[model samples]
Structure formats: structure tokens, C-alpha cells
Target: MKIGIFGGSFDPIHNGHINLALSVIDMLTLNKLIIIPASSPPHKEISGLASKNDRFNMCSIVANCYDGMEVSCMEIKRGGKSYTIDTLKEIRSVYKDDEIYLILGSDMFFSIKDFKCSSEIFKMCTLCVVPRRAQETDCIREYASFLRNIGASVVVLDIAPIEISSTQVRERLKSNRDISKFLPGNVEQYIREKRLYGLGGEYLIKEYKSILSKLLDKNRYSHSIKVSEKAIYLAKKYGVDVRKAELAGLLHDITKQMPDKEHLIMFEKYNIKLSDIELKNKKLWHAISGALYIKNILKIDDEDIMNSVRYHTTGRENMSELEKIIFVADFISDDRVFNGVETIREIAEDNLDKAVAKGASITIVHLLEKNKLIDHNTLSAYNRYTSNFI
Candidate 1:
């Protein structure tokens, strides 16, 4: 059997960590990838670190999403500073007949010589180094050659550099910055739910509201708050995840006020290609840009929430429960006082599907009356939900 060991101080596992792990497992073709979270890293200062259990739980949350990936509390259970040689020795004993591969991030690879029992660590397992930056590839390869000369096996993987760091993630969380793009949705949610990283006393909604207030004008901010409340009510009625619904609603219009140039710049930065219709429709820019902002900057890695934000303005076919809540919430939020709003609100209370159909029909008719272009997603939604009408 081929086994891989990936140990780290996964104080809150982020996308960078996940990307590296997946890369290693795929490249190495390992039978299993054991994720060991360090209880106490010997070489680094352990300031503001999360509790052992919280770290372990966060790692477990991410590991569960991938096959052949498992989290071990060995270092945590050992109750002291974690040493690589000791971990490798323990792992070797378990998989006596199996080949062992040890995965190391760029920092750890560069500083391996300073580690305890470094020579023994090299002999025990093949060292897999993933460079953190493109510029460091040559240096990393040179060092890997040095290791090979000293009878140590080394492999440098050609993976895109992992740009985010745990320290960066902590900094963002400390300042109430959005990290949805940096972390898995569940992991970020776990960090917020547990109030880790000095985020105590400030609830998730309050933090989001603070950030939203800065991004949006007073009217838009007020509308977001109302949408959040309405979404929560609808979530309760529909059995959707209330917090997710609230978050989706609160951030649905995050980039509504961004200028066309800014949105285009963001699209170029993130490599988001736009369809012909999407390029022409400036009104639809917010949903696309806002979802990207939520993912790439705010680092909210929840696809459902991102999609809810992306498609809220133009409802799509086969919308999720949370998506429906936000879509309808936008139409009937307290701030909305347009004609026929009361009827949609009444329809929403009894049947969400009907409310969505009614809402889409209203939007389509309104666009037709004004000779405005209808979004393809809106048309698709209308076709899907109003089949009986046809």
C-alpha cells in the first residue's frame, strides 16, 4: 500500500491547504492520505492558535469532503511539541510494509534541515515539496537536488502556487474581513460558529452587516438588512438553512453600486469570462461580480450562497430552496413598494414555487413593457416553473 502523511497546524484549513492536499494525493496516487494536525509545532511560535479540538474539528470538516483523506489527532493526543521524525516513526510502524510519502509545504521544505532528527526523517519517507510561489520553483528544485545528493529522495510537484496562508486567514478573520473564498464554506462557518480567532461577542450577521454597510449606500444597506430578515422568515417557513438564507440575502447585492469599469477589472483579475448577453447587460453585472467578490475576496466558499447571490436578480431553472427564499425576499422585502407586491407576498406565504413563477412572470412582463432585454436565466426559470400555464 502507498500511504501519504500530510501534517500541519491546520488552525483553520483554507483553500490553499485543500489544493495542496488534493494535488499531492492525485500526483502520488496514494492509497490513503492521513492529515495530522500539529498539537504544538516546534519550529514556530504558537501565538493566537486555536484550541487543539477546534483545529482537529476544522481539519476533519475539510477532510470529510474528499475520499481517502482522514484526519488524525496523534500529535494532539501526544500532548507535546510535534516532531516530524517522531510522527514518521509512528506512521511507519502502522504501515510497516507500505511505502510512505511525506508532503511538505514550501516553508517547511526550506527549513527541514533545522527540524529534529532531520536525517532520519528523510530516510523514512519520500519528501514531496510543493513550492508556494512560481519564483521559488528553481530554488526549491535546487534544494531538492541537494537532498537527493545526500541520499534523500525528493519530488517537486508542478502545482499552482498556494497564495494564501493561515496567518493571512487569521488576519482577515481578526479584522472581520470576508474569507469565504479562502476557506471551505463549512470550515469558515465552523470558525464563525465557534467564534475562533478573537471573533467573540460579534455574531456572524453583525459582522456581515458591518462589512455590507461599508460597501453599500444607506438605502442599499437598509434593503439588505430587510432582505435578510425576510429571508430568515422564509427559511423558517421552508426548512432551509436559516443562516445561509440570511447571508445570501444580506450579500445579494454586494457589488450593486460598483462602476462598470470596476466590474470589468474584477472579471479580468479573476479570469471570469462573460457571455454576450452578460457583457451587454450592465444591470446584471452586480450578481456576477458580487458572487465573485463573495468567493474570491470575502472568501465565503459556499457555492449555494454564491449561486443565490449570482442568480437572485435573474432566477434560474432548478433553484435551490435558499435561492428561492432570496429571490422572493428581494421582491417582497419591506423596502419594496411597487404594484402587486402584496399579491406576491401573499403567494410566497402559501407556495414558494408559485411565488417564484409569479415573480418571474411579473419581471418578464415588466421588461417586455419597457422593451428591456430579459436575462436568459429569468427566461429559463419562467419556462421551468410556469409549465402548467403553458
Candidate 2:
């Protein structure tokens, strides 16, 4: 018997996975292809992932579409961290005389040597790598050398490159964007029917509620609600997507009141490397860190919303109208009573550029009076937008 192994997280198997499987089967002329969903991939963390059963079932739906493709719950049933060597060893025990072809994408192939028991695993199965996109220029020859060093049989198959990815599909779904073109018809319908990706669902509201429950200060919560209201209002005014604006507003200050240690930990966990200035001025980090927390925890995919959160505190050049609205709203919210805030608020209602310029000027003057280092974004925003004030 001839068997081919195709393994992945299959978070929600999309067309790209289907295409890769089909291409490999046709290219290898294999008798059977087993689709294995990892129980837990070692390299990547599974955040916001559906249950193992959900992922396995979706893989079954995709596998049944082709005659030669078969879905295996081997990794899921094994019920611990999934490793390729253990999977191959199990398969070898089941099919003693079969020739095994481990089908992998170019991206995964480059990191083959890092797999657990990689040397022994290569001895058990022949490696079949498909170049889905650009060649692995960074370390292709090095990887090949490492694989051959272990006396492994390897073949690289060239296939039509499909740029679609599960992350891109998930992000599109999160934004209520169209993904029909990138997913199987049944799979797409299933996701929609199940209210997957939280589109038009109460999941986002629930997440907001949970976050709010942890916040003790009623005033801070009120400010968050006000920012959300203002963001929606400005989004409508600027013809931007209203829901995205609302989400950005709601999550912009999520970390505002967290302890410094907790905030730093969150930043590090999310891979947000703060500069020395950012670390010293904890105020600026809340915006950047808050944006990352929302994206990673709440799974918000609106780049406009994320960027709005990122640059909310430090106004940036060429900011989208939405970002400017959030920035000005935060500066002039009802609780605020700074010296020229009223004038800035009045300007914000009519002209965003004038409002942003006034706000940036205020921030710059205050920072200068305090002898603080101003961020480049703030300086650029003041220069570009202050022309209106002149």
C-alpha cells in the first residue's frame, strides 16, 4: 500500500488546504492520503481555536470531497501534544510494508529538522515537499543538507501557489468580510450557519462584558462607553465602517488601569516589544498594548480598529479619519476640562484636521512644558495638521 500523510491544525480547513491535498495526491499518484489534524502543534499556540471535535469534523467535510482523501482523528484521539514522529511510528505499525510519503508545504519543510525525533522520523518515511509559494530562500539548502545528513529520501514537488491562509480566512470572517471565494461551499455555509467567527453574534458583547466586569472604576467604564459612542458617531460622519469603530473604541482603554507589572507581562506575552521611551512613559503603551490584547484575545480583525487603538494616544501623520476621531474623543471626553479643550471640542465637531491640530498642539505644548520626549508621530501630526491652524 502507498500512503501519504497531510497534517495541520485545520482550525477551519479552507480551500488552500484542499488544494494542497489534491495537488499532492495527483502529483504523488498515491493510493491513500490521510488528513491529520494536530492535537496541539508545538510551534504555534492555539488561540481562539474551535474545539478539537469541531476542527476534526470540518476536516472530515473537506476530506470527503475527494475520493482518495481520508480524514483521520489519530492525533486528536491520541489526546496529547501531536508530534510527527509518533504519528509516523503508529502508521508504520499499522501498515508494515506500505511506502509512506509525508506531504508538507514549503514553509513547514524549512523547519523539519526542529521536529521531535526528526532523525528517526525521516528514516521511517519518504519526505514529499510541495513548493506552494516562493522558494524557501532563507534556509532551503541548509534544511536539505540537514535532512540528507540523516539519510532521508526527499523530493520537492512544484505546484500552483495558493496564497490563501487560514489566518486570512479567519480575519475576513471576523470582519464580516466575504470568504466564499477562499472556502469550500459546504464549509463556508457550515461556518455561517453555526455563527462561527462571532459574526452577527453575541460573542463580542459577551467578551466586552467580561472585560468590563474586571474593571472596578465606574468612571473609566463610562469613558470607554463615551469613546465608543463618539467613535460610532465619527465613523458615520467619515463614512467608515461603524461597527469596527465601535469595537476599537470599546477596546482602546482595556489596559488603562492594569498594574504596570501586568501591563508589561501582557505586552511581552503578545510579542509587543516596547522601546525605552514607551517603557518609561507607560501612558503610550496602553494604546499599543490594548490593540494587541483585543486582536489576540477578542479576535478583532479590523485593521482600522487595531491601528486606531495603536495610535490613539500619540497622534500620527496621515491618520485615518477614524483614528483622529478616537484621539480627539479621548482628549475631549465629557470628563475632560483642560484649558483649551472646549475650543478643540468645538473644532472637532466641524473639521477633523483643525481638531487634530489643536489637540496635537495642546499635547505637544504640555509635553514640552513637562520636558518630556515627544514621539515622532506626535511631531509629524502637529506639523502636517497644524497648517490648518495657521
Candidate 3:
């Protein structure tokens, strides 16, 4: 039987890690792949690392998502420096008759000379190294050849480059950016629910979205999800904080289905006083009301996030990038089949201001045709766009 060993800190496993594991297993035709989470990594510092149990559990969660994949607490259970030499020795002893292959990324392979009993590692298992994109084959082959001269069996696997790094995932999570696309849905939900990465409260996205769905009709809930997706797209395009964009888009219409009386009651309870024009225009009530509810009831006090929700409807002058992202996302959401939507979407990809201006123009035209009131902010946004972007 052929067994593969893939080990890492796996602080929180992401999709790229999962994909790489799958690729290696398929290429090597290994009967079983063991994923080991390190208790302590000797090469680099894990300053804000999660607990060993959390890392082990996360690896288990990810490994369980696939067949032929299993989690091993060998490093964590051993309770020391998490040396691979020791782990491999233990693994070899357990599966004495099995052919063993040790898998790692090219970066890790380059550092093998420093590992304790480095030569002993090769005697125990063949080394399979996955190269990073832009890592030249000549360089990899040269190093692999050098290892061969030293009695080490080094095989470089030409796996597809998944341009994701654990460092990038951690940084995005720390900066309040949405990692939904980078992580499995269940794992994302787990991280959010556990309040990992300092994202506390209703920041627990999936549960909050579920609660919102119950409060909304199917169509509206679908729209909210689409808007959230589009918001994230624009956020990435513009380098805005995606987490804030998603939250603003998701909750932008929380108060949309409510009657005027309900908005009034919420406003009164929150002690929120609106302008005469805002009070007269019932359509604009939801934005301010939603902002109030998010901060007061949900206890999310991020000023930028609240502002994004507050201005998604009418859109204030000099809005934040996140506000611009949500406004444009909500306007150009996938469910919106209005004329010029395709045009606005194309423009929004490279020119956000021009797209928002086009959206504002469309909203203004519809209001005029119905002889409904238009907010000054909407007019200002249109003027701003036409003057600067047209």
C-alpha cells in the first residue's frame, strides 16, 4: 500500500490547501493521505496562531470533506517542537510495510537541508515537492538532482498553481475582508461562528444571513445574496474592505418590507431624527433605519460599515469606497434586469464612478416617469458622475 504524508500548521485550512492535497493524491495514486497539523513549526514564528486543538480540528473538518483524506494529530499529540523527522520516524514505525511518500511545497523542500537527520528523512520516504507558480523548472530540477546525489529520492510534481497563501488568508481575515470565496462554506461558517480573527457578533455571516432570509421573502433574500456577491466583487476590484461591503449589501434592505409605521417606530425607538425631505420620502427610510438597527440591536459599531448601509439608497456626497461598492452592487445586482444594467456592469468593472452615475441616472429617470420625489444626494451623485466621469 502507498501512503502519503502532507503536514502543515494548517492554522485554518483554505480551499487552495484542499485543492493541492487532492491534486497530489490523484497524481500519486495514494491509497490514503494523512494531513498533519503542526503543534509548533521550527522554521517560522506563529505569533498569533490558533491552539493546537483548533488547528487539528480545522484540519479534520477540511480532511473530512473528501474521501481518502484523514487528519492525524501526530505532531500535536507528541507535544513538542513538531519536528518532521520525529513524526516520520513514528509514522514509519506504524506503517512499516507500506511505501511512504512525503509531500511538501517547493519552498519547504528548499529548507530540508536544515531539518534534523535530513539524510535519514530520504531513507524513510520519497520527497514530492509542489512548485509555486513562477518557480522555474530548471531551478527545481537542479535542486532535485542535487538531493538525488545525496541519496535522497526527490520528485517534483507539476501541480497547478493555486495562487493562494495562508498568510494572505490570515491578512484578509484580520483586515475584515470576506474570505467566503477562498474558504469552504462550512469552514467559513465555523470560523465566523466561533468569532475567530476578531470578527465578533453578527459578523458571523451565514447565521446572520439565515436570520435575514427568514425575515425576507424568497426573491428579496436572493437579491440580498446577489448584492452581497457583487459587493465583494467590486470591493476586490477597488481594494475596498470586502467584509464591510458584504455586510452593508446584505442588510441594506433589512427594513425595506416594513411599512411606514414600522420605520417610524424603529426611528423613534432609536431616537433617530430625519430631515423633512427624508420623512416625506418613505422610500429613503430603510437605509437610515437599517443603519440604526445594525448598531443598536446587532451591536456592530463599525462606522464605515454603518455609513455604507446608511447611504446605499440615496448615496451621499464624498462617500467611502465601501459605500460606493455597495451602492453600485445593489444597483447592478444579478437579479436586476433593468435596461442599461449590462452597460453599467461593464463600466463598473474599470470605472466605478461612471457606473454609479449611470445607476443614479436610471433611478432618477424611473422616479421622474412616476412623478415621485428624488433626493438631493441622488441628484448630486448624478451631477458628480456626469461632470467628472461622463
Candidate 4:
């Protein structure tokens, strides 16, 4: 029986890894191909690498799509810098009589001679090299001849090279670019769910839900979720970034439940100075503290998102589309049951400015009716949006 050992960091396995594995299995007629996710790769930096479990799980998802491939936790379980020599020896011990092939990318193939215990590794398995591109073939062939002189058995795979890399995939994901062409659907979904590569996708919503669950009561938590949904809808309608809108809406009321003392403490700690009206208006404290908490404590350094949260309660001048989306979303979220919520919601469907103007007018009326001091920002927001407001 011939078994192929294909190993890499697989930090969220992409389609290129899949392409190489399939090519190797077909070319070698291997009975099985084992994908080993390196826990700590000796050749690469460990920083920004995904957890071993996540890498292994991603490999497993890709492997399950094919007939002859499986994922191994051997290197991950070993818990150290993964060396090819040690991994090949472990496989040799298990499949004593079987032929073993070590599948490698061109980059790793060239550096094989420099690996730890390279001489012993050459003796254990036939090396199967997958070129990174067509141009590297002649260079790799020359290198293979050099390895053969040192008693290494090598086979260069005759297939088109996959031009994708893990680094490219990570970069695309971080910048909110679509990765469907580079990865399997399941693997891409797994990365989004895990929030791997610093992606602000559904996983961020899950994280925010957990945080809100602890900080807010049942109603407020539910309200936050509704606001997030409403914000997504409005963002799509208004051509705003949905991720920013979702985050701003969900966290807009993050500090809403804090008592006056807690709000004061946060204000003091963050060196936030409030106007006399802002200090007197407890209703406005959450937006102020929420913005600071997101910026300073949560360390979300996006100025747009911070401003959206800061002014979600009391709309400010020249608000961005995201800011208006969150402000209107908070007022017209599914959980909002005020007397005029339906009218504002209706207005929001056609014109965001009108909805904001109407919502601000309602807020001002409510504050006045209750003899509450309204924040100046609210007045500025209303003035900016409406032409003829009393």
C-alpha cells in the first residue's frame, strides 16, 4: 500500500492545498493521503497562525470532500515545531511495510536539504514535489537531480500549479474580500464562524451577543439584536458597509444599563468631559460611555464605528451613512414599541434623513414632556436634517 503524507500550517485550508492533495493522490495511486496540520511550523512564523484545532478542523472539512484523504492530529498532538523527519519516522513506525510519499510544495521542496535530519528523511519516503508555478519546473528539476545525488527519491508532479497561498487568503479575508474562489464553501464558512484572520463576520455578531448577554437585561439584549438586524437592512438600502452598520447598531447601547455612578467612573477614567446638559441628561450617558468603551477598552480603533456609537443616542452634525443607519435602527428596530415607531419605520424605508428627522423630533418631544434636559447634539442633528422644525 502506498500512503501520502501532506503537511502544512493549513491555517484555514484553502483550495490550493486541496488541488495539490488531489494531484498527488492521482499521480501516486496512493491508498490513503494524510493531511497533518502543523502546530508550530519550524520553517514559518507562528504569529497570526490559527489554533491547531481550527487548522485541523479545516483540513478535515476539505479531506471529507474526497475519497482517499484524511486529516491527522499527530503533529498537532506532538505540540512542538513540526519537523518533516520526525513526522516521516512516526508514519514509518505505523505503516512498516507500506510505501510512503511525502508531498511538498515547491518552496518546501527546495529547502528539504536544509531540514533537520534531512539525510534520514530522504531514506524514509519518496518525495513528491508540487511546483508553485510553471516557471519553477526547470529550477525544481535541477534541484531534484541534486537531491537524487544525495540518495533522495523524487517525483515532480505533472499538473498545473495552484497560484493561491495561505497568506493571500488571510489578506483577502482581513480586508472583507470574497474568498469563495480560493477556498471550499465549508472551509470559508468555518473561517467566518470562527472569526479567524480577524474577519468581522457572523462570528463577531456571536461575540457581541455574548458580551451583551452579560451586560444587559433580557429586553435590552433583544433590542440590541433587533437593532443590528435593522441596521443591516438600512445599510444595504443606503449603500453603507453592512459590517460597520451591524457592529455600530449592536454595540450602540453597550453601556445603556450602567448606573450613573458607573457612567461617571467611566467618564473620569477616559478623561471625557461632558457639557452641563449632557451631564444632567442620564439618557445620553450610554452613547458617550459606549463609544469610549469600544475605543479604549474593546480596542476597536475604527473612528467611524466609534462615532456611530457615540452619537447613536443623540445624533450629531454631518453624520455618516453608518451613523444615521444606527441612529434610525435604534429607533425603528423590531423591538421598538413606541407610539410613533411605525411612522418612523415607514419613513426609514424610503428616506433615511426623514426618519432621522422624525425620530429626533419625537425624542425632543419626549424629553420636553418629561422635563428632561436634551443634549445639544440632538438639537444639532434635528436642525441639520429638517428644514422647518420648531
Count of backbone clashes for each model? 9, 0, 0, 0
lDDT rank order:
1, 4, 3, 2
TM-score rank order? 4, 3, 1, 2
Once superposed on the true structure, which residue ranges of model 3 sit more than 4 Å away at CA? 43-47, 201-390
RMSD of 1: 16.8
lDDT by residue for model 4 over 1-390, one digit each (tens)?
A: 999999989887888888888888888899999999998876576466688899999999988989999999999999988888989989999999999999988889988998999999998999999889999999999999999999999998878988998999999888777888999999988888777887767556667789889999999888998999999999999999999898888899899998889999999998899999988878889999999989987778899999999999889868898999999999999988889899999999999988888878899999999989888888988998886444
Q: Residue 62, candidate 3: how far off, in angstroms? A: 1.6
Worst 10 residues of 4 by lDDT: 41-50
What candidate 2 gets wrong by more than 4 Å, as runs, is 137-142, 200-390
- Per-candidate Cα lDDT values, in order, are 0.90, 0.81, 0.84, 0.89
Q: Would you list the clashing residue pairs of candidate 3? A: none
* lDDT at position 163, candidate 2: 81
TM-score of 1: 0.53
Candidate 1 residue runs with Cα over 4 Å from true position: 1-75, 79-194, 197-202, 388-390
Error of 4 at 136 (Å): 1.0
Estimate, for each residue in 1-390, the C-alpha lDDT of model 2 and write its tens digit.
789999988878998888888888888888999999988766566466666787888889888888989988999999878889989988999889999999888777877888898888888999988776655533555566677877988877767768888888888888767788899888877776566655554446556856865862788888888887887777788787787777777777887887888888887787878777777787897888788877887777778888889999988999997788888878777777779988987887888888888888898999999988888888899998987667
